[model samples]
Target: MVNVFITGASGFVGSHLTPILLAAGHKITAIARSESAAQKLEDQGITTIRATLEDIDVLAKAAGEADAVIHLGFIHDSRSYAESVEADLAVITAFGTALKGSNKTLITTSAIPVAGVPTPTELSPGKIPPRAASEQLTLSFSSPEHSIRSHVVRLPPTVHGDTDRGFLAHYIGQSRKAGFAGYIGEGENHWPATHVKDAVQVYKLVLENASGSLKGGEVLHASQEAGITLKTIASAVAKRLGIPTKSITKEEAGQTYTFLALFLGIDCVASSELTRRWLGWESVEKGVIEDLEGSGWYFEETSVTKF
Candidate 1:
């Protein structure tokens, strides 16, 4: 059984990931920021370390001791997105410092939005999204000279399932408030997606297969649906909430979607073809729209028209 250290043990992906690793007979040392979270993990027979992303020393030590380190922790403060990106860079650096020459695995989380399509002009440093920048930096630690097996899983903007209370939930809430489910433009812009179960399966596969066989600096996309249309998503929300779906202009979208306007207006489409070829990850679970329309829990939350 490999000894693994993981961050974000209490999050959406981590919550599901911990059990699968345990069932596979691996011991886990989870990093937590709160006593309640630590106790909860300890009760599950997993050891806990109290630390935050800011605790570089603790993170380095934790990464050094474990056979593998999976970093799933991220702060999504929209107002401080730049700061969050810097924090991610710092965390990766600290982990690299600790695991240097150990040839251990470092699995960090990234998103497809930041992994935009290749451009001809070459992406300027300032033009690159913080998440994408962090991903590249993590992969840089994978060379023979570095001696660290660094892997990055680029997730879809929407990682959905039965209990998803993330972006979709927020969108549903906004739809109810607006009295109509809205999509920007003709709603042709697409968002990539993956079921939480499928995502968990990929993580397990990566951890299991990422020894000497799977090379370091590999960037994998955890995308199931390459392009789930915005119209389709808006329709799902509308049908469930007994509301109408409408296309809103860019100017109108900013007013209605608020902080989510930028995302709502983006195409942000991605694929997992490479990931499937490399890791043999096939997503057989339900699609995003199907899950959203069928999930009773999802509708229950959106049923609340008031804040």
Candidate 2:
């Protein structure tokens, strides 16, 4: 059994991932910032470590003891993007220091938006959007000399699924508030997407085959749908909410959207062909619009929490 250390173990992706890993006979050491969260993990037969991303020593110690580490925790404050990236960089540095020259595996999170090139590829080289330093730090420790098998999973901007209170949820909530579902400028900009289940499986495959299946410093896109038009996403939400979909100016969008405005304006089409070829991974699930409209249970539940 692989002794895996995972940050963000109680969050959306991690919550789904832990059970799968356990079913496969992997032992999990998960980090939780609250007692309630820690208790939840412990209840599920996981070893809980009480700490936040700020606890570098705790992270380092946990990572040092594990056979592998998956870094998924990040500060979600969009207003403080710089601080969040800095924390990620520091946390990565700690993991690298602890696992240096051990050839142990480390998998961290990046976003498809960071693939600055128009057509995103696994080999596309660029600083991650908003925070370039963090990705650079992650890729730098992935050499044979460092002896750390490192990789970055570039997640699509929207990973939709059950209990998901992400960007799509925010759109639904805003649609309820504004009396209409809105898209920015013609809404032609495209955003890649994947179901949470599919995305988590990609992570599992990468972790299971880290030492052999993937090259160090490789960037894998977790996108199942290469790109779905913003207009399509808006139409889906509008249809669900029984509201008209309208195009809003960027200035109007700034006032309308909370933290998702900047992202709504971006067109990121990421390709996972290389990741699929290398890891034998494929996303066999409903696409974003289908999930958002037909199967997604989030809309049936409470709209009180706006995330």
Candidate 3:
């Protein structure tokens, strides 16, 4: 079994990934910033490292010795996005140095929103993702000859399924609280989607198939469907919450959602043919349809919710 050292093992993706890797008979050493999270990793039969992004020494040591390192610990404080991004860069740079000569695998998470194409394909490499600058930096490690097989998996906006209480839940909850399910203008801007289980498979496959071209590194999109229209999503939420789905004017969308309004307004349809062709990945998990039905958040937290 290959020994894999992973960061953010306590995160949504990491939580699912650790068990999957363990089931695949891989030995794991998970990084956790808290005792509770560390204990959780230990309970899963994986070794634990009581360290965080700031602990450069510990992280360097861990990356140097492990067979591979899958980084997932990203600071998500919206209030401190820039600071968190800079810190992430520091951590990645440290790991890149740690695994410089070992030719080990370093798989990190990125998103497909960097480019504005309504539908992005593997053929579109220079697609500049305004939201995902970190991806560009990580994949830059690729060169004519680099020992490290660094790769990026651009996850969907909604990495949904039964366990998702993230964006979709928040939006639906907000909608119910507002008394109407709302989507930005005409609600035609599309968001790509992938099941959490399906996304996890890409992680395993990249680690399993670490080799030459991967050494130059690659960008993989964990997108199941190219696009799911905002109108459809609004309908789903409306139906689930028993509210009227309505389209807000562009002006209102901006006033209500602020920074998120632009993203929610973008029409993106991303293709993951490369990810599938390369890894033979098949997202066999429940799609957004079941995800909306299962969360039951629409019914549970209705009274206090605000759109």
Candidate 4:
């Protein structure tokens, strides 16, 4: 069994992922920042380490002891996004130092938006986004000189499932607050998506094959649906809220969606063809629109919590 060290083990994707790893006989050492989170992990028979991202020494020590490390923790604050990115880079650096020349596996999470391409593939070379530095650093550990087996899994904007309090949930909340769902002009800009279940499996698969099939520094895309139009997503929210869907100007989207305005208008389509070919992974969950319309969970709550 693999002795895995994981950050963000109590989070949305991590919560789903831990169960699968446990079922597969893997031992998990998870980082928990709160008593409640620690209790939750302990209840599930996981070893908990109380620490935050800034604890580089503690993170490095944990990485040294584990057979592999999966970093899923990220700060999502928009106001201090640069600081969040800096923290992520520092955390990855600690892991790299601990595992350097050991040939151990290290998997770091990234996003498709950072690819800066119409349809980003595994080999895309642009680092236009702020979070790109972390991605670049994670992959650098895989070079022959460093001797660390590293991989980057780029997630889509919408990792949707029940109990999801992400971007889509925020959009739903905005629709409720405004009494009408709003989208940018024509809403032609697309947002890539994947069900949480499908997304988690990619990590599991990467862990399972890290030593055997995976080459170091590979970038995997977990996006099942390359892109879905914002108009379509807004319409789904509108139908659920029983409100009209309105097309708004980019200037007006800022006032309507608040922090979500910029994301609502970005086109971040991505393809997983290479990832599928390399890992033989397939996404079997329902698509975003289908899940939104059929789940009944997204609209059941009167209040949506922003994540």
* lDDT winner between candidates 2 and 3: 2
lDDT of 2 at 144: 71
Rank candidates, TM-score, best first.
4, 2, 1, 3
lDDT of 3 at 249: 78
Model 3 root-mean-square deviation: 2.8
Q: Which candidate comes out best when scored by lDDT?
A: 4
Model 2's C-alpha root-mean-square deviation from the true structure amounts to 1.7
Alpha-carbon runs more than 4 Å astray in model 1: 77-79, 118-127, 210-213, 302-307
Write one digit per residue (lDDT tens) for candidate 1, span 65-158. Answer: 9999999988665447789889989999999899999989899987777745531011212234767778787888898878998988877778
lDDT of 3 by residue, 1-307 (tens): 7899888888777887888899999999977888998888898898998988788889989988999889988876544557877788888888888888677788887667766566787545535533356776667666534567788888877777544555666676567667777788678778998888888888998889843234446888889877898888888878887889888977775665544565677788999988888878888877776667666543576322112
Expressed as tens digits, the lDDT of each residue in 1-307 for candidate 4 is 9999999999888998999999999999999999999999999999999998789999999999999999999876554778888889999999999999999999999988888888788888547667898889999999998999899999998999987888888888878888899998898889999999999999999999943678798999999999999999988888878999999988888898887897888887888998888888899999999998897678876646555
* Candidate 2: stretches off by over 4 Å: 77-79, 304-307
Cα TM-score per model:
0.92, 0.95, 0.90, 0.96
TM-score of 4: 0.96
Clashing pairs in 4: none
Q: Rank order by lDDT, top first?
A: 4, 2, 1, 3
The residue-by-residue lDDT of candidate 2 on 141-250, one tens digit each, is 88777888888898888898887777877777877788888889899989999999999988899888743767688888898999999999999888887889999988
lDDT of 3 at 29: 91
Residue 202, candidate 1: alpha-carbon lDDT: 78
lDDT of 1: 0.81
